[model samples]
Target: MSDYFHNKRIVVTGGAGFLGAYILKGLQDRGCGHILVPRIEDYDLVRPADIERMYDDMQPDVVIHLAAVVGGIGANREHPGEFFYKNLMMGVQLIEQARLRGIEKFVAIGTICAYPKFTPVPFKEQDLWIGYPEETNAPYGLAKKMLLVQSQAYRQEYGFNSIFLLPVNLYGPGDNFSPASSHVIPALIKKCVDARDSGADHIECWGTGKASREFIYAADAAEGILLATERYNGPEPVNIGAGFEIAIKDLAEKIV
Candidate 1:
């Protein structure tokens, strides 16, 4: 294991969350021993004052910002305003605070949901702004997309060592199994498991069975983030993906 992160004091904003667990393990595997995770309750990152205090308390050399208000389409629709406001505030405040503190590096994790609805089959970083995201998810998508803008601006103006990454839909164990907020994978798993136990014959799902999506295992996504944190320092965004897409219908069939 390379000792690139051996002694660097790294602060992962969402270091205790679903994806955060895998990322922490990945960092540990690479011999990164100095990781600080300040929970959201202790420091509500949406509030500027808390953001400032967290930065002051942590005094980190590197920050991998993964803290976000995210969930499946149902959650997004029910909490569009909350999602946009909280996500925008957290990312904006976190990046700005990291900048003011003169940190060594800032890594921002974006989502595939931010892409335009009709993006070409294999989405590319350059095609991010060609159009708006799907209506159901536009609010959440645009809110997170702002991070890419913020990261690029910071790098250009202050020459900050910040990089933004876009990861496709991620799923694996330790996922949020809650029906109200779980993403497609975990939500479907829960539904199928419950039905199987009750001896149900069929399941119900949303959408027209036309939308397609790509996925990256949670562990793989974590490794990709660590790799970007250590090896990549450019302003241009990079994608962490499995390089394969599946139609929603096909995915559901396989899951069931």
Candidate 2:
């Protein structure tokens, strides 16, 4: 509903990814025409030279750094090093590059997993440093959390207008449905649909289904990101969550 982004040259890394694709579509729908997307094949973000090449080519007004190695608890537990290395390199390289190029704005996407594992319900942004993250996701979460630190420091020393957004679990269409890579909602939807179609009496789920989570529809997350870009600019990271939490079992039942 806002035209603040009109004619802006926005470069969204990982534009082919699940969340990145939705953000790109939202920008297009809101009259943003000069949207530049660089997929992994186009540029390896972990490599500084590739990122430099992209900044030289695009020269965008804003850089939305959404590229990373993401997965559910299972995947994170299995690939800790890959999760840490890829995410850290991508965030560090991209933000530094954007700052060097004098980009007007840089939007870094953070995650709720950055909060401490024992963080109280309704996790606050200031609570990010209270304790360590959940063991399963510490590597991946900490990697992205570094962006928040970099953004703040850049703003302090370099006067760069970089902002970080922390979003909770996101789900919608265009999500990865593969069991190995998918998040809770899509994975459950796929499993439930398949099991129902196959006449299974019951399907088991992980973690007792009592662990609560907050999920935002992908479209809403995109809208929130754009809104933050236009109205909010500050050093501390802002949470873009739905403000409502649900038990995993309840979410699975809704899908069923």
The prediction achieving the highest lDDT against the true structure is 1
Root-mean-square deviation of each candidate, in angstroms? 0.9, 1.2
List the candidate 1 regions with Cα displacement exceeding 4 Å.
Answer: none
lDDT of each: 0.90, 0.89
Candidate 2, 18-101: lDDT as tens digits = 988889888888899899998778789899999999889888999888887888767998999999999999998899989888
Question: What's the lDDT for residue 137 in model 2?
Answer: 91
Candidate 1 on 15-132: residue-level lDDT in tens?
Answer: 8899999989988888888889989779999999999999899889999999989888888889999999998999988899889989999999988989999999788989998999
Clashing pairs in 2: none
User: Candidate 2, which segments miss by more than 4 Å at Cα?
Assistant: none
Residue 122 deviation, candidate 1, in Å? 1.4
The 10 consecutive residues of candidate 1 with the worst lDDT sum are 26-35
- Candidate 2 shows a clash count of 0
